[model samples]
Target: MSQATPTSQSQNVQTVTIEREMNEYGALTVHVDGQNATRHIVEYASDELKTILRQLPSGSSVPLTIEPIGTRGNAWRATSLTQ
Candidate 1:
């Protein structure tokens, strides 16, 4: 398993959406603008993040601080999230 580390500084991403269901690996997937531009996934989401997601409705646009997870820069993770 790849250890998710913040490769770079936090990026201000807009129009972020967190999937309601977890993937096969039990990780929460996130998308920007309904597309897979920056494949951000939360393998272990914080309690705060979970609370935020549960309160918001589906397809709601939220602010997120995304960072590249691995050295490959192909995968990302949500370091911070806001409404």
Candidate 2:
């Protein structure tokens, strides 16, 4: 058999700020400071989330990854920013 790609093991995630969001009652809410439309949270926060958002533009498309939290159920944490 052939060797597998070394980069295949890791997942690349993307995300956009779309304004600041908050976690309320176990739900991460997506809301804008001056907007009225709000969406329910899809995932919780992790070190990965912060790391990714830091790189992506405030409104650009990007990738985001979801990793296991070790038996506490899986969480979608941000990984890196992308075009």
Candidate 3:
């Protein structure tokens, strides 16, 4: 038997702000605002995305295309960013 990998489903573009914080485990975590005022943690981010996030000031929102990651789909990753 073989286990199947989870496919990444790109979500609609949305305007959101990002923040970096330390989780309970003391690891750095990046969070973004989702639709309906929901908040999601980014488990994976590309180098480009990281650069953009770093340049953004606090509470700055930008248009981005994100995709849900992980089997539970509780985490997200930035696929595209529009400054």
Q: Best candidate, TM-score-wise?
A: 3
TM-score preference between candidates 2 and 3, better one: 3
What is the C-alpha lDDT profile of model 3 across 8-65, one tens digit per residue?
4346467776554425432223345554444454543576665655566656677777
Q: At residue 30, what lDDT does model 1 achieve?
A: 58
Global lDDT of each candidate: 0.57, 0.38, 0.55
Residue 43, model 1: lDDT of 38
**Window of ten residues with lowest summed lDDT in model 3:** 22-31
Name the weakest run of 10 consecutive residues (lDDT summed) in model 1: 36-45
Q: Over all chains combined, what TM-score does candidate 3 have?
A: 0.57
By lDDT rank, best first, the candidates go: 1, 3, 2
Arranged by TM-score with the best first, the candidates are 3, 1, 2
Deviation from native of the Cα of residue 26 in model 3, angstroms: 12
Q: Write candidate 1's Cα lDDT for 2-81 as tens digits.
A: 66544344554566675544454545555677565645455334766655555665455677766665576456555577
TM-score of each: 0.53, 0.30, 0.57
Tell me which of candidates 1 and 2 scores higher on TM-score: 1
